[model samples]
Target: MSYLTLFLTAFAAATLLPAYSEILLGTLASQDYPLFWLWFWATAGNTLGSVVNGIIGRQVDRFKDRRWFPVSETQLHKARNRFNRYGQWSLLLGWLPIGGDALTLVGGIMRVPWLNFVILVAIGKGLRYAFVIWVVLKAGAMAT
Candidate 1:
C-alpha cells in the first residue's frame, strides 16, 4: 500500500540513516493516495523512529566507550541541560536533517515529559508531511 511505503520511508529517514521519504511522498501524492491515511502513517513512523533514538540516548552511558559516537558525558550533560529548557522550540524545526533525531534523544536524556514530547513531535511531523503533500499536489496540478 502507498501508506506502507510512506511509513517505511519516513521511518528510515528519521533514523541515523539516509532515506528518500520526500521522494516517496511525492510519488504517492502524484498517484492520488488517501491524504489523511498517508499523512498519519508517515508522521507515526517518523515519530517512532525518533523515539528509538530517545531510548538509545537514555542508555547513553553504555555507549560512552564507543569511538564512532564520541559524544562525551560532559557534552551530553550540557546538551541535555539546554534541551530540557527549549524542547518545544527544538521540536518546531524537526524537519531539518540531523537535528530532528538528535533533538529527540537529547530530549529523553534531558528528561522531557513523555506526553509533551510526543505531542510536540506529532505536530512537527504532521506539518512536515502536510508540506510534502501540498508541494507534490501543487506540482501535479500544474502538470495537468
Candidate 2:
C-alpha cells in the first residue's frame, strides 16, 4: 500500500498537476522501505505519466484551431523554438520541477521517438529518485 501510494504520487507529480512526491520518498526512505522498489515504482509511474502528456501533445493539434484550445499559437511557437534550440536532449531534464512537463509535451509535438522518450525520461526520473533516497539515507545516518 505504501508503494502504491508512492507510485501514484510520483505519477501525479510528473503530470501538469501540482503534486510533490519527494517528501513521501524521503519519509519512506527514513522508515527503511526497500530502496529498489521505491525507485522502480517512482520512476515507472512518473515516466508513464509523462508519456500520457506526450500522447496529449500528439493529439493537441486537432483541436488547436478551436477557441477552447488551451495553448495559444504564440505560446506554442515559443515552446517549439525553445525545444528546437535544446533538441531532444532536453528530455533528459524531464525530472525538473518547472518546465519539465512542457518538455515532455513539446517532445511529442516535435515527434520524438517513443523509445528515446522512454529511455531519457526514465533515466532522468530514476536518477532523481535515487538522489532523493541517497540524501535521506545520508541525513538519517548523520542523525544517528
Candidate 3:
C-alpha cells in the first residue's frame, strides 16, 4: 500500500498537475522501506507521467486555435524555438521542475521518437530518485 501511494504520487508529480514525490520518497527512506522498490516505483511512475504529457503534446497542435486553448501562439512559438535549438537531447532535462514538464510536451510536439522519449525520461527521473534516496539514507546515517 505504501509503495502504491508513492507510485501514484510520483506519477501525478510528473504530470502538469502539481505534485511532489521527492518528499514522500525521503520520508519513506528515513523509515527504512525497501530502497530498490521505492526507487523503481517512483521512477517508473514519474517516467510514465511524462509519457502522458508527450501523448498530449502529439495531439495538442489541432486544439491550438480553440478558445479554450491553454497556450498562446507566442508561447508555443517560443517553446518550439527552444526545443529546436536544443534538439531531442533536451529531453534529458525533463527531470527539472517547472520547465521539465513543458520540455516533455515539446518533445511530443516535435515528434521525438517514442523509444527515445521513454528511455531518456526514465534515465533522468531514475537518477533523480536515486539521488534523493542516497541523500535521505546518508542523512539518517549521520543522525544515528
Candidate 4:
C-alpha cells in the first residue's frame, strides 16, 4: 500500500499537477522500504505521466491558436526554439521543476520521437529518484 501510494504520487507529480513526490519518496526511503523498488516504481510512474503530457502536447497544437489556450504562442515558440537549439539532449533535463514539464510538453508539440522521449525521460527521472534516495539514506546514517 505504501509503495502504491508513492507510485501514484510520483505519477501525479510528473504531470502538470503541482504535487511533489520527493517528500513521500524521502519518507519511504528513510523507513527502509527496499530502495530499488521504491526508485523503480517512482521513476516508472513519473515517466508514464510525462508520456501523458507529451500526448497532450501532441493534441494541444490544434487548440493552441485560441485566445484562451493554456499555453500562448510565445511560450510555445520559445520552448520550441530552446528544444531545437539544445536538440533531444534537452529531454535529459525533464526531471527539473517548472522547466522540466514544459520540455516534455514541447517534445510532444515538436513531434519528437517517442523512443527518444521515453528513454531520456526514464533516465532523467530515474537518476533523480536515485539521488533522492541516496540523500535520505545518507541523512539517516548521519542521524545515527
Candidate 5:
C-alpha cells in the first residue's frame, strides 16, 4: 500500500500536477522502509512519469498557437536555447523542482535526441529521488 501510494504520488508530481514527490518520498524514507524497494519504486515511477511528460509535450507542436497549453514550442525553444547554452549537463539538475520537468518537456518539444533526453532525464530524476532518500534518512521526520 505504501509503495503504491509513493508510486502514484511521484507519478502525478512528475506530470504537471504541482505535487511534491520529494516531500512524499522523504516522508516515506523517514519511515525506514526497505531502501532498495523505496528507491526502485520511486525511480521507476518518476522515470515513467517523465516519459508521460515527454509524450504530452510531443503533442505541443499540434497546439503551438494555444495560450493555455502551459508550454508551447516558442517557449520550449527559448528554454531549449538555454539548455543548449548550458550544455546537456543542465539535465543533471533537472530534478530540481523549479525547472525540472520544464526541461524534460522542453527537451521533447525541441526534439532533443530521444536517447539523450531519456538518459539525462533518468539521471536527473534518479538523483532527485536519491537525494530525497538521503534527506529523509538524515533529517526528515520519522514516520510513526
Candidate 6:
C-alpha cells in the first residue's frame, strides 16, 4: 500500500477506533518502502488523530456535569483527581496501547494547553513509530 494508505491507517488506529497501523507499517517496511517517509506519515497521522481526541474531550467537558451525560459525576471527579495527581506528564503516554486514546481524551477534558498537548502527543507518537521502524529495519537486516 501507498504512504497515504498507511497514513489513513495510522490516523484511524490512533483514535478510539479499532485499527492497527503498526502491522501495516511492518508489512510496508518489509516490502522495502522508504523508512523515513513511512515513519513521518504514520507519526503525523497518529498525532493528528490524538489531537482530534483532545478536541472531542474538550467538547465532552462541556456536557460532563449534565444529569443525562454519559459519564457519571463520580467518574468525572475521579478522572479529574487522577489527572491532578499525574499532572500533564501523563500525556506522554499517549503512544501506549489501549489507554493512550483515553489519556489524550482526558488531556482535552482537563483543558491541557493545546500547544503542550500537541507537543507531547507528537513526541509520544513519533517515538512509537520510530521504534516500530527501527525494529522492522533490524529484523530485515537479520533476515538478510
For candidate 1, write residues 1-144 as lDDT tens digits: 677877888988878889978888777777757888888898898888777776777778777778887698688878877776765568655667767888877766665667777777778888988999999888878989
Instruction: Give the per-residue lDDT of model 4 (tens digit) for 1-144.
Output: 988898899999989888899999999999858999999999999999999989998988799888888777888788888889988788889999878998898889888899999999999999999999999999999999
Q: Per-residue lDDT for 62 in model 2?
A: 85
The candidate scoring highest on lDDT is 3
lDDT of each: 0.78, 0.91, 0.93, 0.91, 0.75, 0.90
TM-score against truth, every candidate: 0.86, 0.97, 0.96, 0.95, 0.81, 0.93
Kindly list the per-residue Cα lDDT of model 2 for residues 86-117, writing each as its tens digit: 88889999999998999999998988999999
| Model 2 clashing residue pairs (backbone) | none
RMSD of 5: 3.1
Candidate structures ordered by lDDT, highest first: 3, 2, 4, 6, 1, 5
Which residue pairs of candidate 3 clash? Answer: none
Candidate 6 residue-wise lDDT, 65-125, digit = tens: 7878888878878887888898889998999997899899889989999999999999999
The CA-based lDDT of model 4 is what?
Answer: 0.91
Candidate 1's TM-score reads 0.86
Candidate 5, residues 1-144, lDDT tens digits: the string is: 989888888788877887777777777776768977888888778777877777776778798777776665666678768877876666566577777787667666666666776788778788778877877766644533
What stretches of model 6 exceed 4 Å from their correct place? Answer: 65-68
Worst lDDT 10-window in candidate 4? 70-79
Error of 2 at 11 (Å): 0.6
* Worst 10 contiguous positions by lDDT, candidate 5: 135-144
Candidate 6's displacement at residue 29, Å, is 1.4
Off by over 4 Å in 3: none
